[model samples]
Target: MAGNQEPLSPRARLAVTAGRAAAAVSRAAGRGSGSVIGGKVALRLDPDLLAQLANHLDVVLVSATNGKTTTTRLIAEALRANGGVVSNALGANMPAGITSALAGGSDARYGVIEVDEKYLDTVARDVTPKAIALLNLSRDQLDRAAETRMLAERWREALSGTKAVVIANADDPLVVWAASSAPNVVWVAAGQEWKDDAWSCPACGGVMQRPGDDWFCGECGFRRPVPSWALSGDEVLDPHGSAWPIKLQLPGRANKANATTSAAVAAAFGVPPQTALERMHSVTAVAGRYDVVGYRGREVRLLLAKNPAGWLETFSLIDAPPAPVILSVNARSADGTDTSWLWDVDYSRLAGHPICVIGDRKLDLAVRLEVAGVDFQVCESAAEAVTACPPGRIEAIANYTAFQDLRRVVGN
Candidate 1:
């Protein structure tokens, strides 16, 4: 609802108005996915709402285990160089949010969509985006139903003949394998910080071994594909080895990779490196991610780590030990029903650090921290924990639902 550049006809405007009305009613009733429900209502009335709305719009669909929201945000921001971009920054990847996002904008020239991993194939088949950026893949932890390898296979099969160009992280073998399925792909040498899930060759089911930075499968001779764009150190390097300095408002190498990923996709869409870098560096946060908030006279920098892989990636960004950290967990519907993934994370990395455990699954985290010999105290909420921390920028990490809960608590 933030950007709308085109004017709609009387009938189309009425449909969008009806959808907005539904969204207002849903929000007034305190319902989740108001945008989704609103979009659904609009779709019910006009079955081809998204197709008609985004008929001439250049669409970029993004999917991965993590970094979908932030990556989508970066791409959208960069694409603004051309014209308005209709995007869903609400962590919504399904029909409802995608519909609202595509239909809400009347004049935007592009749509940057962050799709849910499970729904990627379905969404791609329907929308036929201009570019599909695959960040990386790992176990989502709570959903034991779908496997990562199978998802890649499905992606390959689904995109076999699609017109969209695929921009993928070559460091992630699963991503490479999946993106390779598409007829056209622009491989990116974006490093994969986490490689545990991709130990097996997605092509031949052979064992994959890393010899230095390159991966090769022994049994089937499958190997890494050459990348057109590569992230080396703090620079995004092209195939000719020309480097573009990556200056981001976000922290961590993971984020640098994300910015580079966005740059690569945007460049493929014809945005200049200088312009793309400027737009991407302007983003300090995406939704609630990496937001620094003031609550009860303490500064709490919020971070989200939903699974073991996410925790492993996030820990690299937090200040080292003894700095007093707040760790919150939850097992609600959005946070996954299983809290067992806590055991999978290497909280031992913060072995000597002081951590204030909070949330519905704080006890579970406490037990895991205790087993790792971490110093911790239980608090009623993340707000309380941050308030009790030392007088400095306090680091607070949480799962999906708990992250949202912490924001509400801190806001009040």
Candidate 2:
């Protein structure tokens, strides 16, 4: 009994030492958000420890089916633009990662965290952000769950206790429904034409028809009200397409949706609408998510395809399949893990190819592309896939991962 007790005390002491060592190393490496830990990062922490860590954060929760990361980045930028210090390290949105991010910095007025769809409830319960931005909720990561309806349910639960002012996407039916309970919700709607993909109402099972790009319940006539800030346009112009424009740097309609949503949220925080728009124009792209770069003397664009709607939006952005597109799919326990959702993507939206396929799940993507009658060459690895394409011809590669396999290959 004495020997066992001796070991337990020593083991507990060692754990404390290890925790301190980790914190020291994290600080030395300039990591922040020491408070807001993510479940995906530290899966088995006891509730008390988790609560201790979270108590230090002034978290700003950001969730959406499509554009959380992009929108989160934009919000961070807007906050900075308006002379407020913000805590946001790219791609670190979970509780542990967000904690680490906050730890990296010491004096930020706000913490802008992009919350994972599944973990939204946990983070919301823990972080208790000053403000929550609910971007559009579309069908994403279908392999993780059966349907978007379930995600909507989880979101409703996550947002229930957030006394923070809510900025929601007025364009999405599912989001509008989920956030209906928030009294302080500021509805942000984009222009009518931008609401191209509104799904039907989950409550009444009614056909949700686009009444001039604004949504209306076709069967029940329940109107989805317009947003406070809306962007109306026929063609999304990336002025940077011709020249490196000093004002606005991003391209495509999906980007416009992201920029507009960012503008609205910034305005809600009292950043003037024009100031928000001006700041938005300064963003070129978010990394690994429709991020564009010059690689090997050719333009390389990365678009993350985790779900069907993301795929559709990516398809909508590119102009008729830029030459030598590379699509890599990897299976990770963190990122849905199953490739069956590949079937649901509108791969037919992309026509023609010198398309190269790569990843642990490359064969799955290859099979899907073949069945869909698209021409593609399967590569053994991501680097080889990039190598296979001649410089300048291979313009972009859209790779999926829960790990850095693709990033290591593309070197971006």
Candidate whose lDDT is highest: 1
Residue ranges of candidate 2 with Cα displaced over 4 Å: 1-20, 23-58, 82-84, 191-198, 218-221, 234-247, 288-297
| Residue-by-residue lDDT tens digits, candidate 1, 1-412 | 2233345556666667788889999999988658988887877776656666766678899999899999999999999998888899887778768988877666788889999888888777667688899999988855553788888888788778889889999889888888877898988888887888899999898899998889989998878888889888999887667898997999998888898899989987789877898889889988878998888777788899997778998999977766668899988887788887787788888766667999998888899988887778999866578767877777888889898888888756
TM-scores, all models, native as reference: 0.94, 0.79
Q: Model 2 Cα displacement at 267 (Å)?
A: 1.8
- The top-ranked prediction according to TM-score is 1
What is the per-residue lDDT of model 2 for residues 247-359, given as tens digits with 9 covering 90 to 100? 34665666666666666666656675556666766677676555555655665667676766667666665665456777877777646676776887767766675788877
Candidate 2 matches the true fold with a TM-score of: 0.79
